[model samples]
Target chain A: MAFQLVLPDSKSVSQAPSPLAYAVDRTFFYAAAAGALAIILLVIYILWEIGGQALPAIGRSGASVLVNTQWDVQNSSFGILPQIWGTLYSSLMALLIGGFIGVSIAIFLTQDFLPHSLATVFRTLIEMLAAIPSVVFGLWGIFVVIPFVRPAADWLHDAAGFIPFFSTSLSGPGMLPAVIVLSIMILPTVAAISQDAIGLVPYKIKEAAYGLGATRWEAILKVILPTASGGISSALVLGFGRALGETMALAMLIGNANQISLSLFSPATTLAALLASNFPEAGAIERQALMYAALVLLAITLVVNVAGTLILLWTSRKMAKA
Target chain B: MTNASVLEKPTATAGAAIDCNIDKIYYGKFLAVRDSNIAIEKGKITGFIGPSGCGKSTVLRSLNRMNDLIKGFKLEGNVHFHGQEIYDKGVDPVVVRRHIGMVFQQPNPFSMSIFDNVAFGLKLNRFKGDVEERVQHALTRAALWDEVKDKLKASGLSLSGGQQQRLCIARAVATQPSVLLMDEPCSALDPIATRRVEELMLELKNDYTIALVTHNMQQARRVADITAFFSVDISQGGRTGHLVEVGPTDQIFDAPQEKLTKQYIGGEFS
Candidate 1:
């Protein structure tokens, strides 16, 4: 009976459908559907749980929680404007640096600039960078990146002290070091996705470009890059999201100062860094505030991912129309 | 004077547009095709027809160094265009392709406007002429101007399959290349579209040397002034494709010298 319903046009069956087979099929379908529905519910549950814990702070501060930049513990006034700014600023800077390098690496690997075997080797090595633990990246930044960026930061401070970006001296871990480490940390995500995007461009389209006598750079710059721009842009957006939420490396390297400074050498804090460092030993009000900040980070990441997805869809439609 | 010139049919010049003396074509260690000697005569249409895996497209791509884009693609041969070796150490493949343009099997118009697609080559070659006039001339020659002249700003991908193919042809001709290599240009279109493209080829032969790879025997007989036959040999533990015979289209269709060519044209393998 179930066979008739399921395979209405398949008349080659010699025997009637077994009830056991029908039961198995129904059970498998329900199991898979349950798995899918579970994830959706879990996501909503996480948002609800975080929002519920953050309600006290949200009710106390309201929209001012985002705009105010005070965090005095003795008098009990808490505002996370600097952390919000740091998160956005650092992530954008990282995206600019990492996004350029990542897309260039992707193009170099995918556009026949390297041998096939060498490309595979380099791709594997780049992806392996993602597997390293966040704490290890933090340790590496403290030991390696901090040293490398300090002298340059000091040089810029000395040579071009009039510029706001280089006005502060690099006495310790600062925004420049954190930004450099964060950029390196996000390189794998950007490069891998961009490589996939560039590689996915149909071979036929590339052949058409070359068939017209376009040199390598011409074909790449005029045709391949434009065709893959949507994917690359989305990749950068996702990288920005990753950089925004990065906690350990930024916390270790950003010096955790709670002020906004124009100088790249000034200490700063991010939302993720603030949450990770403060949540361990917080009083009643501060804990709620920390949870509220976590919610903001989640909201920012959610917005970025949604925007990235929309950009992907829009560009694909435009590409299809063309 | 115009009436008398129009009455006279265009004839093939004695000069060879692209001459090839190929020993072997290989992808890494595997021999793909071998032992081909052919010359595309100026002001005529030459067709390369054979069964699948016969390396007709391989030889066509080798003429313009398009195969150089493929990894492990190595050719032990010399392809000369207008008496200059294309595969020499100093000859840039880019310059070779600029002079010897190609149309692929698929109508691969770029993701750009119709006018941009036709002008892509002209811009690459740095043509200092009036771009709009040149684009119009190419479209007119490709027989696509009547259909697409008004919508020149429309995306090339928006057109029908046949129109897109003609757009590719127009793009190829807009560069004013001395030779055009077409690899099965009509296999993707309907009979009517194929007829239109074939007519465009006949009209184009007056100005450009054309080499075509076709699967359809009747299409070759209809449009090609000369046809080259290729067949694959499996006796060597691998399918090695080679040219069998090349002659006038009438001789190839009516009386082929080689048994493989005769069998292929006679529908023995189909």
Candidate 2:
């Protein structure tokens, strides 16, 4: 395309549309709408392809394909229950731990308690933490984090052994290790989004708090946090999404066990991990089982993402009212 | 200008509400305000009139130690509330702020219910009386209760600009502090709303001492007992604001001692 020199000549013509120009403009409008429609078609096509491939496995067991735990490759029986449990609980653990740490870091950095120059430096460091490759975190977890978590896991087992969640004994890579590494991996993502959300709160609101004789802690807790809650939650949603789909990091540390365990110390596998590990070696039925698991993961992600968006909208409406 | 013109006539210690002996305020090394002195009188309105960036708002903020939040903000001064120095060692800014409340130029209502907004200061101070009655009393005193009595639970932001300002006034007044600092409180309001606020200020003077910073000369003439005019002094490094004249409202407006104050009030220059 060449740059053309043209000035807007106000005197040349009226803004009223000509017949030919109107037809051309109408075509352009339809063209743009079709471009948007292409995305919807693409999503539907992928879903159809996946559904067709997995239908045989789904038809054989019906709902048991989701609930059954048996995976006998010799007899060709499979279930996604353990992987589902692993994915859900591990992602929840990651969200709780990572969301807490992310929000705390965001609050600390955004508060006026620190000098502006120093806050800027700390914020930059956290962003850099977010940019580190996931495989490196998984590797670091293998060498450094696994050792640290072992003693903590043992102590947890001893102190709360009566509890089902803390009953298992740890040897190496497991659910807890995977959860911790995932949490750390998502921390900066959460922090970065939360920083933006907290930063979006108007300065005048904080001033209002201080003007009413509020301490810095009071102002932040009572005013700034509530005002930024919508954005903060969106940050959490992004973190949750990232944790749900993360493959290399969780796959490396999850120990790739196919059985479900209530204990944090027990080894586990996730949907992404199962797909990564088994897809290369699987026969038709096993491959179908993995596809079914991926379908379930996709469904869960959609439900969760919709719920998060609704919650965010609810908070924003409340903000508008208040 | 004469010394008395630069600094207000010294009121008795017992009668002064808040007094400032400010050497300078600085952002890093750049001075914002220099050599300022003023004594606000008890149960009366003292008005600060000046052009923009003349440190009038800075002085208003300094009264409650609100400037402490700004990075690189350094002040060489002592602010006394009644007889005790507010910036003295062991005097917490939080506690100092509780004794003196401020209203901003913008009507910044907390993002909560109107009832909660009125109750914010009372709860902060741990008011040991009937909370509901106190909120009602404060709102009534701010002249917003009659309009918003039924919808107390409505969000503070749902109110009009003027009503929000009144809500803020009610919030500040709920603490029942000795001094009320208003920094152009009516600047964001409509003319009718501004009149209402001005009227409310006159009524409030019966119970509270007010130090007002305003851009409106007519507002000062109508409501202030003492008027202090500030002007920017431009020199080599930067412009520094300092008090140019201080006297009774009529004298300051009718016979401004400094040429700059005359230029300002006479509309010859800002």
Candidate 1: list runs displaced more than 4 Å: A1-18, A313-322, B1-14
> lDDT by residue for model 1 over A212-260, one digit each (tens)?
9898999999998888889889999989989999999899989999989
Clash number for every model? 0, 0
Worst 10 residues of 2 chain B by lDDT: B1-10
| lDDT tens readout by residue for model 2, A45-134 | 989988888888788877887887866778888888888888888988999999999999999998865777998999898889778898
Model 1 chain A poorest ten-residue lDDT run: A1-10
User: For this target, which candidate reaches the highest lDDT against the unseen true structure?
Assistant: 1
- TM-score of every prediction relative to native: 0.93, 0.89
